[model samples]
Target: MLTLTATPVLDVEPAIHGEGPTWDAARRELVWVDIDAGQVRRATVSPAGVVAEVGIHPGGGTVGFVVPSSDGGWLLGADGGFTHLSADGAATVLLALEGEGPAAGTRMNDGAVDPAGRVLGGTMALDETPGAGSLYRVDLDGSVHVVLRDLTISNGIEWTADGRTVYLADSGAAEIRAHDYDIATGEFGGSRVFLDLSSDDGPPDGLTMDDEDHVWVALWGAGQVRRYSPAGELVAVVRVGAANTSSCAFAGPGLDHLVISTSTQGLDEAARAAQPDAGRLFVVRPGVTGRPAGVYRGPVDALHRAE
Candidate 1:
């Protein structure tokens, strides 16, 4: 397998816990979340791997993931549930995830916009309690549905180009699961183990797919991102100087550069000191390109009524 090293993007600020990295094709910007800081950051990335901050939106509480909507607003998985952050910076809670099914102790985690324009997000307990997480899907019409239950820590989420298959990482379980998906109905069929890392490098945090259909997964504590073939063969490894590598996305104008987000969330003082670039964003050219990220087409006007 091929191995490569990633370099930090010196222009960006380090996030306390950077988790989700997404490419917004419509605006030609890179969007990601600093979960612990409750911030959604937007930036412009050059093909040569330089990042310039554009805007920062504060979500009141922990912001897990953010996706641009076709309605000019942005939808995000925040502390309560799916929220709408209007273009003018107004916050509207579309659905309250806690108290109905998940307990108040739980908060939304990583999520992604599906090909059908719906948003699928998962939740986990703040304290990382086992079996206290679940995945949910929000349709374009503002309806919510539970996708999966009994998950420990729901992290990375991605889908095949055809939207017939989905891969989700249950980090606490140290495994990623692949499920048969239906874009027409936004439902999931049988799911099976896609990648088991219980005894491997590290727990899977976030992941993305390239044009070749290979999945690249970030290893939380292993300081690396790994690429695997569609048939589950290890093909390449991208090493980062930071041990808490969180997530990655194919960004840049040509989508040729892989933008990675790291963290210092669980590191001790000494460990944090050893890795000076722990929370900085990193980039590397992998000779591969990814398609434009999925955007949420859900309506937000009705969300205000629900709030």
Candidate 2:
């Protein structure tokens, strides 16, 4: 098994729910979101020391995810719509899902861009109920297509380097599932169980792929991140002092450093005091390089034709 040693990097005031870890290699920074706090946080690291709180999203409309785009900006998933948020804090809605319909409680949750630059994300019901969620694929043309359905707390999505396999984590079910992917056609098939989290270890939240194509998953409530080979073998475990680890990403200039985000939500005063590092950012050198983040291709126009 792989041994892990984590070091606290940044301690934020109080992030109720911290998730969506993304790295911007060009800027040498890491960006993430505080879901309940309605803020996006950024940390810039240099050869000398770490500078924390480089940026923030003050308007705070339940921002769920943020990713660097090919256009030198970010694609943000917020309540009611998906939009582009520039470094200066300007927002533009690309697609809105707030129309009067069954998708009312649905808001974008976890998402990741495919190797071809297409954005694939999933939605979850506000009430966190089962069968009230759906997965969507957003193309460069600003169109959204529902690709899958029946999910709760949709989280942690990544694609294999070859683009032939897609991995998705359903936190509510404590399970990670994989799908056979068709890069050229933008289709997915062969859904099967990829990994299941033990109740004692908490549930799987967000995950990232390493150079070897193995998956490293953040275990919420378990206070640890576990690495698993592509074949689903447990390879390593990195322990954190916080029980509510939210998500993780490989950052640093070389993409060799693993940055993890944790949460302070649902903890009492005693628990919070016990885990002072809760809701803080942690980093460590994991000796593995991460695939560069995929760019958001927006929405595809041919989605309607596919139906």
Candidate 3:
């Protein structure tokens, strides 16, 4: 397998818990979330991995992920449900996943927009409670449906190039599963183990697929992002500076730059000192390019002003 190392982006500030890196092709920007800080970040990066500009928007509370909207607003998994951040800095709840508020101690976690423009988001308990999470799908018509359940930490959602296969990271289960996807109907069928990382490096966190259809998964606490072939073979490994590497995506004008997000959450002072680069962003070129992230096509105007 090939090996590479990532370098920190000096121009970017560190995040409390950074996750969900995505390349917005229409805006030609890199977007990610700082979950613990409830912030959505956007940046303009160059081919050589230099961050030129950044914009931060509030996500109500504890955002799981952020995706560009068909409208000028932003759609994200936050606090109790999916929220919309308007272009003018207004925030709205949009849709509540649970009841009026998040169930007792749970919050929305990582999520992504599927190829069919449907939003697939998940929820998890605050204390890492096992089997306390469920994945939810938001259709274009403003309807919500439960997709998968019995998950501990529901994270990382990505689809193959053809949009026929989905890879989901059940982080608390230490496994990533592949499911047959129906792009036309947005239904999932027969699931199988994609990568059993229970005996390997670390739990899979976020995922992205390259142009060649290989899946790249960020291994939380492993300080690495691994590239796996279509047949589930490890092809390359990108070493990161922080153990809490949360997520990654390919950005830049050509989509060839691999941008990674890290977290300092859960680390004590000593542990934070050991990984001084924790909570910072890193980048590396893996000699591969990724496709643009799926944009959310749901009804943006369905959002009501947050009370």
Candidate 4:
């Protein structure tokens, strides 16, 4: 179901399982990960329709997520939990997640920086076992906590511009959920379903929010990205050429241009042949601006050791 009519293909990164696409405004670069391929990429992007790979992640174990560091380097989520990746590829293991550290089959998945500059990392079982995933957060004061547990296929985790609401996607449930959040305290209230995808439309994967309070979500097997209003009403839909549109982030000037990451993980040869753009990057201007991706303002000393 690859259809590109108005939006243009931005980069042909051709990642095997492109999962996280984030815009590092401080560095003015687009950073994303190829999870299955165990790689990371930094791209220089321009509104003039130019995108180039400027750097690479130190390749080794499975790398799932990456975001810019206010201090420098990358806040990385990979095997055995979170770490900091320096410019020279040296990694400093920060937090050893609960299940990941014990070789218990769980791996770090998607994550987002909270308004207070802490990271909320999610976990998923390598076997996709039900109720094996959880969402954990690292606070500014060097506290690591499991805010939510018993999740399956936990994917995107983002917050509203005002930081009053948090949105989480559990692909196994085929829905996006929202929670009341305390920006200063990093607390979460009970959540309710924000949007539920029809079983046939595919599961909701990763998502991002725009300044106008719209949440844009990628559909893993549906070959489309959908935008929803704050009230949970569908606003728009953009068809991507790939069935595995894993995640997306707003990039470029004003954070209005959407940079998408796709995956070729489960595609067989025939499926791959039908969708040639399955693993390339796609960009579209959706007429909305997103908040800047958050960076860690937490005590740097806390990131030096595992909790």
Candidate 5:
């Protein structure tokens, strides 16, 4: 059992949609994105302040998620394609999602790094078109693999500790699905329903797994983050008070604090006023630590590694 507590805002700077909070353990900082505003922000955990910020959209698209790269840069899943954001603030196009711009107005959204460090990013249609999104994985060998297709608002992705199971949230479907993962062969199968939510509970948004392998999901319109066991049994729920909780990540010295991102996107004036903290970052600790993401590997690690 976990001790659920009230979540408090960690950062005061609200965003149109604050999301994808990734912990850079090497720097002891929290990195996240203001999606609609097209900015990536970072803050030192101990110091509890915004350290450095960069806008990646000027290079041509909005960033959905960012993971630390081996070369001290970041691998960003952007609207146009994937961009490698250099430490000097340069956004280099790594690959394009489409030959031209997204035809269906789709762009990368929530994502997670596989145990091999390859990035698994999901896309969502800007126009909210059903079945317009898909799941793609960028390999170390410089290859892009489309893992799944015909999805709507492809979001939250995670794998079990052993790297043999994958849990993905298809927000449009309002459910999370699990797949059998082959860590050695870089393949996956056996996707089945893990959890489904009703309109009242809110749609599943971002996801993360704790040290115990319990899946923690942020409910976009529910104002809460819930945890479930590997068997998909609800374990705990933490109230965040924000209607649109986008994503969450474990942070702080012990990685025991669960920090969540919120959003004001799509909210009318009345809705925004009702939830003033709608687009800020919040943190709460339920006496659990988090798994650190693996730094992305390069060609040196090969697409196929030893089992």
Candidate 6:
């Protein structure tokens, strides 16, 4: 068992709904989102680090996740669209989901790049209505395809190290579903419950897989992050300073450190006072390496087209 410590890396006023913590190894930085704030934030990490807030943006609308791109930038999931947000802070739309009509919620939510370098993101209804959500795959050719539907609060997505299995968490469902993944064809099969939290654990929020194939999940409203073996056995629990812990990732120069993102959204004055670091970013050296973040290899360059 590894001892966990919560170090406040970045202190911000408040994040309404923070999620999607990704490590950009090349730049030694950590990137995340504040959904209700409609912003994406980056913080630089150093050996004797004092986490500095590097950048922030309107994020088009309720940005949920941002991943490094093959072209040396980022792919940002915004309100019903995938956009290109460069390291220098310029933003451009790459794909739009306007055709989804009334079913279309406010914006996209949690997302991650598959081993094949394609972007896989899920959407949620702004109104928090049940079944008003969908998961999508954005191909390199700028095509967006709905891969799953009837989801409420689509969140916490990751793939196994071998790229043969996909783990998706539906917070509302209180279940983490696994699917046999095909990297060559980008298809998912053999869907079933890998871990069910409705009976014992809290709602699953964000997730990350370690080098040993263990799944680490953040439990929203439970104030903890749990590690589960590949076969769905609970291994460890890393407590957080807040109940609204949203997402987590392994970052730092060596990808051995775990960073968690929490939220203060919907918390009243007394509740906020109880958890003063609710929206702050926390880090822990878990003594385990994590898989590098997959890059967004989609049509991000099209954002730079000449007028």
lDDT per residue (tens digit) for residues 1-307 in model 5 = 4546555564357878888888878767677887776677777665232323333333235778887778776777777567777777677776776622366577888777899888888888888678988888878776888888888988989889999999999899999999999887668788789898855479999999999999999998888889999898888888887888888888877787788889998899999888888888888767778976667775322232122
CA displacement after TM-score superposition, residue 44 of candidate 6 (Å)? 1.4
lDDT of 6: 0.81
Instruction: TM-score each candidate.
Output: 0.96, 0.91, 0.96, 0.93, 0.90, 0.93
Candidate 6 structure quality by residue, lDDT tens digits, 1-307? 5436567654544567788889887667888989777788888765543466677866676687888888777888887768898878888877677643234545788999999888888887877667888888877776777788999888989999889999999988889999999898777888999999997657999999999999999998988888899999887888888888888898777677788899888899999889888888877777677876899877875532111
lDDT tens string, model 3, 134-226?
A: 888888777788888889999998998788999999999999999999998788899999899998878999988999989899999999999
Best by lDDT: 1
Candidate 4 ranges with C-alpha deviation above 4 Å = 1-11, 198-200, 299-307
RMSD of each: 2.1, 2.8, 2.5, 2.6, 3.7, 3.2
12-45 per-residue lDDT for model 4 (tens digits) = 4588888788998888888899887778788877
lDDT by residue (tens digit), candidate 1, 272-300? 98998998899999989987779898787
> Candidate 1 versus the native: TM-score?
0.96
Clashing pairs in 1: none
How large an RMSD does model 4 have?
A: 2.6
Q: Which regions in candidate 1 have their CA more than 4 angstroms from the true location?
A: 100-103, 303-307
Determine the C-alpha RMSD for candidate 1 after optimal superposition of all C-alphas: 2.1
Residue pairs with colliding backbones in model 4 are: 2-241
What's the true lDDT of residue 85 in model 2? Answer: 73
